[model samples]
Target: MDGQHYMERYIQEVVRRLPKGQRVEIALELQEMIQEMLSADGEEVTVESVLLKLGPPKELAKKYRDDRRYLVSPEYFDNYLWVLRIVLLCVGLSVIFSAVVNFFLDPKQAKEAAMELLYLPSGLLAAFGAVTLLFVILERLHVKFEPSQSSPWNPSQLPPLLQKKAVISRSDTVVGLVFIVLFCMLLTFAPQVFSLYLFSDSKELTMIPVFDMEHWNVILPLILASMMIGLVDEVVKLVTGRYCGAVLAVNAVTNLCQVMLSFVVLKMIPFWNPEFFSWLRKKCDIPDLLPYITEEAFSNLFLGLIVFGTALELGTTAYKSLRYGKN
Candidate 1:
């Protein structure tokens, strides 16, 4: 390729890594700088030589970035990978241990125990994502995990102090996504496992399902859809890495959908276990407690809490995004 093409490719590499708003200006500036350097020699200097002096495109891009954030920069990349490997190994081993214990606990539950092993991949994936996200946030926050042992501690020795910015807490969002995944998995495969266990005086065990499995099956799709929306919202927040009207808007829409799905689950469908109340009456000595506690009443209380939580999240996001969105 010609020198001009090489220069164009080099500029494109650096500018493409930048935000869209800065790309055009930065690209033009880089072209001018390269041209000046090429002319300053007063001889035909190869574009390769000029590019070499400028350094790699990735490093040049980093210099151009005002924020200087990286997912896992070279300095801490080794530590990040170390932690990631440990996390994944721990997650895998824990899943295996749980599965083994479950199998031994009830030898007849072999199929059920096998199902537990299926979670290993998801658990490892979540662990990997969480660790990577934590590192990314730490990078953006300019947090140092490995301070130099050779040098004495001094304020001057510190890395460039990062300015406080309105960034979406990527770690928290990842955690939320993990929980959503777990919740959806539970509802999808083993929701019947969520039960109230009672042991009689004779050591007899009784299990009462938490929700009417029949009705739960009916609303499962809606619940899953709402959760999927929640996942999308978190992913958007993760990508944006800053609170703004767009994030707030997404939060508002997802929360609304969740609230509606919750309403349908709680009010329209007979979600609670039908025999749960009767079992309580039969099994409990506290008669007065049973009188005040009805399925409808419990549903209403849960719905109210969901609404309250939604309101609080929306309010907080609005305050932050509106206040510091431009920043």
Candidate 2:
């Protein structure tokens, strides 16, 4: 490649590692800097020599970011903010949803519904703390979105411009993470809410608890751990913002942990409330349903579904990683 091609390749490699919004502006600045350096050298210095003296595109990109002083660091800051926004959105929506549900359930208790709004600030604070903590851990571990700094880089090693398909969607990852967080929160704070609500003849509302509280309490930590593994997996996706072997490996490992934890939870005991089935059968007048959908049978069915879902996720992630990793 000639001087122009060399410069373009170098600029592309640097900016492509950065956020999309800043890429154009940074590319222009880099081009101007390279031109100034070339002009200063007159006709004696080749573009290759100039680039070599400037060092690798990766290092130059770091200089452009000037991200050395922070706990999370600049490279990961954009993603940190992205995750924070999604978490806050999820928290806010949960508060609103809770308030709305309470209001609909009992108009006389509108004051109580209004009181639920107080949880908003606390929820947002918790969300911020969780996201910051995750980023800090990543930073401490030196988890990098860019290629590792241990490798040598040269002008010839300039990576090609990123392809469209190689990019992971922030929105999609956010949606998935929001669901995971909400599910975790629901189980932790209000597991009993997963109940069958009924209206009695006297217009009294009745809630039949789904899971035996004793059993749920016993297994809650394991379930939360499983969910946390999933949370970490999504964090990896957010940081990398693209498909790669690392993402595939993390996905596989986390999914496997989730599978094992889920199996353990299912095997420890039947989670269903002992009274729930009897009440359900009485209410529905379907005593025969017990034979077909016993606790053991339900546990087996749930385990099978979890295994199938994990397999599907691993397969999809593998295909995407391999297809885009080459790019």
Which stretches of model 1 miss by more than 4 angstroms? 1-106, 115-165, 283-288
| Residue 281, candidate 1: C-alpha displacement in angstroms | 3.4
Candidate 2 lDDT over 1-327, as tens digits, reads 778888888888778656567889999998998989988989888788889988887778787666566777766788888888877887788777777776776779899889988888988898899889999989898776445656666677765545678778878888789888888767754565688888999988877788878777677888889988998999999888788888998999999999999888886666788677777556665666757556677788999999999999999899888987653
The prediction achieving the highest TM-score against the true structure is 2
The number of clashing residue pairs in model 2 is 0
* Structure candidate 1, residue pairs in collision: none
TM-score of 2: 0.84
Instruction: Assess the local accuracy of residue 118 in candidate 2 as a C-alpha lDDT between 0 and 100.
Output: 85
Clashes of each: 0, 0
lDDT of each candidate versus the true structure: 0.71, 0.81
**C-alpha TM-score for every candidate:** 0.59, 0.84
Q: In candidate 1, what are the lDDT values of residues 1-327, reduced to their tens digit? A: 477867776786566456656788998999999899999986778877888888766568878654535457654454456556555665566667667755654578999989988887887787688778866865676643223346432222222212245667756875776667667655655565577877789976667887887776587888888887786677667655567777888899999999999999899998888778777767777767876467888899999999999999999999987877642
For model 2, the local distance difference test gives 0.81
